[model samples]
Target chain A: MTATLTAPPARGDERLARQSAFSRLAGRPEIGALVGAVVIFILFFVVAPPFREAPSIATVLYQSSLYGIPAVGVALLMIGGEFDLSAGVAVISSSLVASMTAYQLSVNVWVGVLVSLVVALAIGLLNGYLLVRTKLPSFLVTLATFFMLTGLNLALTKLISGGVATKDISDIDGFASAQAIFAQSFDVGGVSLRITLLWWIVFVAIATWVLLKTHLGNWIFAVGGADASARAVGVPVKKVKIGLFMTVSFLCWFTGMHILFSFNTVQSGQGPGNEFLYIIAAVVGGCLLTGGYGSAVGAAIGAFIFGMTEQGIVLAGWEADWFKFFLGAMLLGATLLNVYVRRRAETRK
Target chain B: MSLVQLTGVGKNYGNITALSGIDLEVGESEVTCVLGDNGAGKSTLIKIIAGLHQHSSGTYEVNGREVHFNSPREALDEGIATVYQDLAVVPLMPVWRNFFLGQEKRKGLGMDSAFMRKTAKQELLDMGIDLRDVEQPIGTLSGGERQCVAISRAVYFGAKVLILDEPTAALGVKQSGVVLRYILQARERGLGVIFITHNPHHAFPVGDRFLLLKRGRSLGYYRKDEISRDELTALMAGGAELEELSHELDRGGGGVAAAAAKMLEQESKELGITPGSTP
Candidate 1:
């Protein structure tokens, strides 16, 4: 009976090996993003003369890192079958907390940063808790958080600083060290590379490792695939989801700190629309909105594409408004490509 | 001693009685087949035994000690693994990942991917399931192969009593045969198996004991030697009720319903059951 069900012997082992190898490469979640990045790079390199320069490349990398850091977290959350619509306002909220607390209390910048971290994590926990306990859709829960945070960010900033932006904290104690850690740039082959770029690489590396080399990685996939089934098999569904939301909050705090210290001031309305960019990067990186299938590295590559396009259009003398159109196209195209790749991989078996 | 035993076990949900007066014992190296049609409280019974739900009244024992499980985790800790019909597998996840989903091997804060992949492949092979690649998503496998994976996962996890819920209900004849073979292999390995199904044809050959259920109550439990396959099928289909239906259809003749009734009468006769006989 087993012999009858086994694969045909007529297909040589060598052929089977080759087929699997090809399928594996094609099946990778990041393959679409990688290809998109390469195409965007080539297109910009051909059309934008300045894009070929090292400094311009560094600038693109810097911009990519800004979105790449959070996109990694968003990808993981999405893979776990949840969304954080508040992610955008959450970044601004964190920055506002850090800046306002530093100036209002006249405390060390590091102390303000700590306060901001707590605030961000609390919001994330609330999102996760409400999602699990109320059994509400994550989209609605986070959307509510998004609106609340958005309102608070603006109102609190105005109330505290009497302006739409926080007071500059560049002269506060520990500000220099914080800047060095988060916002400082170093020369790389005569082109100054922002430290955020290094942070982005580290973030992507850690997120990728977690997704591929940890039990939590398996849980994320399982929970996203089928929560009830995963629970039946002993996977802690609620904990994984809560942890994922917290992970997003932690990333948002990091990004928020970077934004605050980099400029020494944060605008009250700076983060409202950026959440879509993070989601777009994840989707363009081949993450399905339905969840259970995606990669952190793919999201990183997706952000890289975003950075290149945003910079490429400016360098190529095209209107920056066209960037949104390009992003929309990429999202649709990447999703279609990912669907096709998944079908091919499954059918090969 | 029985690996798991239940006596006068019953469950109530508000005003409805889901199961009543169920006495079952699953021993080592044996298959105790629970035969039931839809709404026969099969799911409720398994949920109670698997610790998803507590029995409203009964003495449930594991290893001769009374036990009450609050959750499926407790049940698993007690080595009673339930492989649901859906297989409890993440469809989009790779085979190795699903195999070691909650129980993963770790090395220095990271999963031991190499070891997990190798062990998953070996375990599946040991269970006589051959896959082209363990890295492939489990959704790519056939329904039978997925069920086999779920069974192997339970066995690997040290389940002393394996309760399978309709493992063959959605499978084709060949796939059903494959799953039956796995059940036999599991029994040979000295694991007490509770094979739940409405199909007696699939159960009779592999089961050592048959427990027939109807309307949330056990009709009776029989050893393989105490009952013939025909008798088992007849009982599962409600022998007397089926006979009466055949006569009714015979009265409303000249249609497909009458034809089906005629076929039922022929089958009943072959099984040595006379029409209109007591159930």
Candidate 2:
């Protein structure tokens, strides 16, 4: 039977306008982080005299750039509603492999980096496959990978360095070439910033584009949101989940190689506890643990906040040990705030 | 020729027989009604035809061609579409998106966003559903609206034989009325409709033939012109015994309640309500 009530001609436009208004008013986490970043910067500038300097701000962004690259990958995975605790440990594992292969094995840097990436991707794929197949919690699977890779990092480093903390790649054939590309700095407004900041920006742009503008990005949200519904409608749930896991792993390797090439030295203890930090950045950036909803740029801004605070605290003449306490406090506060923000946005509709 | 045929079909879960010795047929452009009580193999018949379950014995045919379907995808490929009570529509998604879910249009190396929305709107409007906003979440629509959207989706996908398990089972009078209209519309559009419902009244008006089932065995199949609605309802409710039971209830509880009960019996008798008629 035909419905007696027909929709108005302007109905589609009205609904779209309403949705856009809701999104604008709800303020996605990334936008919140941008606002928070300004607040944090203003607070630090007012409290610490040196923080107002262009050189000091550039230093914070330069340092933030390093952690920011890994955070972008972490955020994408988190948005898909999975975790990779192994990422932190993988950093050192991948860096050590790349450095040792290049300096110790006398291989080319690119070849060494490729080997490291292959290993990381393998771990990620195995972890994702097991998680999807068994339907087990990701925390346990990635935790196991974290410890296993952590052990491998130490064992391999010791095998090559003979009990040393780090291996010197200073005289390696490609050391200068690698350093020029990864570690080189340029003067901008009398403040020298590492080239890694540019890498961080590119990562943020690409990650944001994929999450918002592409079909793969849509699947990422659906896979994390309600997998059963996604599968019922014929979305390839398992394949998408596995692919996201591998993306996280590959990104971790990429960031690790960036560090190795920048420093011309590799240490065994490089990335051990950094996984938690990356997760913290993502959380502060407005990602939900429950999956299905999050922002990639929010996570980048989250990394920026951490980067600023880490260097900002020192600029304010505070003891570095207190940085942990500050980070813990911010993560808890941001999570609580994110929960409130998300609940309001969802319920408003 | 039969569009779908099931002969000696049976299904078992461990030791429990969900269906047994089922013989059925659905012809092109004709509505076939399959009636049975709960646990009398109604679900089993639908599942086997829907490709959700396979038959353990006998053969299933489409267009007089014997075939086996291993999955629902295979069934759809052969033009047999099953619409369940739940409808499989994502509530949060827009109507247009849900309509073309797995079969979305693509353009310039990506999903053709404009084309999908435009075609979905046109399809619904053609079905007499005047949706002002195709972008509103499908969940916001009433139950009748949801079923209409689903029926339109099935019809648009080129289903040659549509099997509705219990379309009106969960609906109110007005809502069921809406669905019945859509079924008749589909029939007029030339697709064979398998109207599986216990309600003979719902089937009597539209069905071309009726298959009376009791305890997993077919009582008989009768052409619509040969059987009256009262006789079909009587056969469906186990005939004269139920009429005697209804008459007995009125005399024993004769009061204000008896008056209401008598009124209900009169309505039931006049409308020829059957097992599938009640909620």
Docking quality (DockQ) for each candidate? 0.54, 0.24
Over the stretch B73-119, how does candidate 1's per-residue lDDT look in tens digits?
89999999999998468888889999999999989999899999888
Top model by TM-score, which number?
1
Q: Rate the local accuracy (lDDT) of all candidates.
A: 0.89, 0.78
lDDT (10s digit) by residue, model 1, range A1-349: 2213454334333324565776567778889889889989999999999999999999999999999888988999999998889998898899899989989999999999999999999998999999999999998999999999999999988888999999999999999999998889899778899999999999899888888889999899889878888988888899999999999999999999999988999999889888999999998998877789899999999999999999999999999999989988988898888788667655555
Highest DockQ among the candidates is held by which one? 1
lDDT for A233 in candidate 1 is 89
**Candidate 1, number of clashes:** 0
lDDT by residue (A271-317, candidate 2, tens digit) is: 87788888888888888777766788888888989888888889899
When candidate 2 is compared with the true two-chain complex, its DockQ is 0.24
DockQ score for model 1, please?
0.54
Which CAPRI category fits model 2? acceptable
Lowest summed lDDT across 10 adjacent residues in model 1 chain B is found at B270-279
